[model samples]
Target: MTCRVVQWATGNIGTHALRAVVRHPDLALAGVYVYAEDKAGQDAGALCGLSPTGVTTTRDVDEIVALGADCVLYMPRLCDLDVVCRLLSSGANVVTTCGEFHHPASMAAEVRDRVVAACAEGGTSVHSTGSSPGFISEALPLVLSSTQRRLDTLTVDEFADLSYRDSPELLFDLMGFGRSSTDLAGRVAHAQAGFGPSLRLVADALGVPLDALRSHGEFATARDTTEIAAGTLRSGTVAAQRITVEGVRADRVLLRFRATWYCTTDLTPAWDVRDTGWQVTVEGDAPLDIAIRFPVPLDTIASVTPGYTANRAVNAVPVVCAAPPGIRTTVDLPQIVAALG
Candidate 1:
């Protein structure tokens, strides 16, 4: 059964997803939705560095809805609930890299209700997944917990060495990497919103619903002016940052997620920073310490990082399309088997 897939938003992650959809053996390119007017009427394949796919891209949302694609790979930078609801109400399943929908229970009641209504109306499913919260935080923890009869604590540590990342706007301006002072409130809120849901999902799966989710941010300043791929980090500027989100149960931290991102090793506090990868530590009856590393060179990491996020969403199309209509989480779906043939 060949599923018709729509490639939505040809950005970084979207570009990778578009290429994969075109090459997938069990999927056919149905339509493409682009936000930029310049991309409208362009060949989908040309946008993703592949041979022309004959499917022209359109900027109109109605045109995409009318295509009736079996699934839409919604990989936009920021999630728009209206657009997502529109797609779902039009009978197209959606598998997205957006972090918010990973756990629908974590969403506001009104927001969740709206999506539920949309799914009911069109008889379709919507799933949110990606490498970080999807794989490391939710899926991996659940697998490790299977070995334990007595579970104590599970921690997920994510490390990103952004020394070679060349996105000035993302690193310097948006993330405040090279800024004089870090915005603790903003970072904490963002971390809580982005990763708190994954922690809640894991806690719920373990049958220990959290009493509350707490988040905090810490930063280290540069000891000396350091030049990175993005730009120069002046002395006393924020050179390293760590955001931690924890799920508490019975007044104890049962699940924890920590993200450590750094552009240079030369910092006032001298924080421990590793190569781009993830570390999962499970402390229980069956203790396990696992490390997943990205061996790609730092210089070329920008070109390779998108697949980490995009591929999972691409592999999930079939599972999402086959799922019962609702907001599907990693727990709701079966193990995503990559259709690489």
Candidate 2:
């Protein structure tokens, strides 16, 4: 039973989803969704640097949805309520890479409500997952809890160098940095402000209320600004962000997340606890530290394949997609560990 798939967006994540669909025996390429007018009517394969899959990109989302795809994998730019409602009502299940699902109740309140109602009326399903808040934020901690006797704290750090990325917005747009120190200060003041959903997941996982959460910022820049290889990015500047969420009742830090981005390639990439790699630590009666490095593949296209990140997204899909039609959080869904086929 090949799952017919219509992938939205053509960015890094979207490219990975498209490739996975092409390679997966259980998935079928149905169509590609592009919001940009210039990219409309283009070949999905050519746009993503793959051989043609015969699925042309389309701006007519309704037409694509009506084509009878079993599922729509949305990896494109964020769409509004009208579009979301239409997609849900189309009777196809949905999985997105957008952060909208991080906290369906917080940032996307109206969209969530509309989706829930639409899914009910249309008898469909929808779920959203991503690398940062989705996998690192939700899945990793859950994985750590199964083996440990007592769980004290869970920390996740993402160390990525966006210097190879071709977008200037990659700095501010994705990483949430600023052009200057003052601008960055303002940004940091509200950095953790949008993290309600991620924190909610942690709280739900631990069965506790979110008591206190604080975030601080540090900035680093390269010696020079305009000569980086991917593009002429300002040198001597980077954003190092740390976010902490504490449980008041537990009197301990439940979830700690930190991400640092370097504008250039000269500096070393490392994390505080594990140093230069990814690690999950569970400290209790039986202490445990699980360390794994998500190797950044050399090829640009191959790098976006979502390796560990996909496992996180794919693992969560069954829970959310098969879940009763409604807007849900990590806590709202049944707690289950991921298993490989």
Q: Which 10 consecutive residues of model 2 have the lowest summed lDDT?
A: 267-276
- Model 2 / residue 244 / CA error / Å: 5.2
- Can you write out model 1's per-residue Cα lDDT over 1-341, one digit (the tens) per residue? 89999999999889999998999999999999999999999999889999988999999888999999999999888999999999999999999898869888889999999999999998999998988868888888999999999888899999999888888998988889888887878888988998899999888988889999998999998999989988898999998899999999888889999999998888888887777899889989989999899999999888898998899899999999999999999899999999888
Each candidate's lDDT (Cα)? Answer: 0.91, 0.61
Best by TM-score: 1
lDDT of 2 at 134: 66
Residue 337 miss distance in model 1 (angstroms): 0.9
Clashing pairs in 1: none
Misplaced by over 4 Å in model 2 are 104-111, 162-182, 185-195, 220-251, 263-277, 297-302, 305-321, 328-341
Q: How accurate is candidate 2 locally (lDDT)?
A: 0.61
Residues 191-237 of candidate 2: C-alpha lDDT, one tens digit per residue: 46545468666666666656667666666544455544345545434
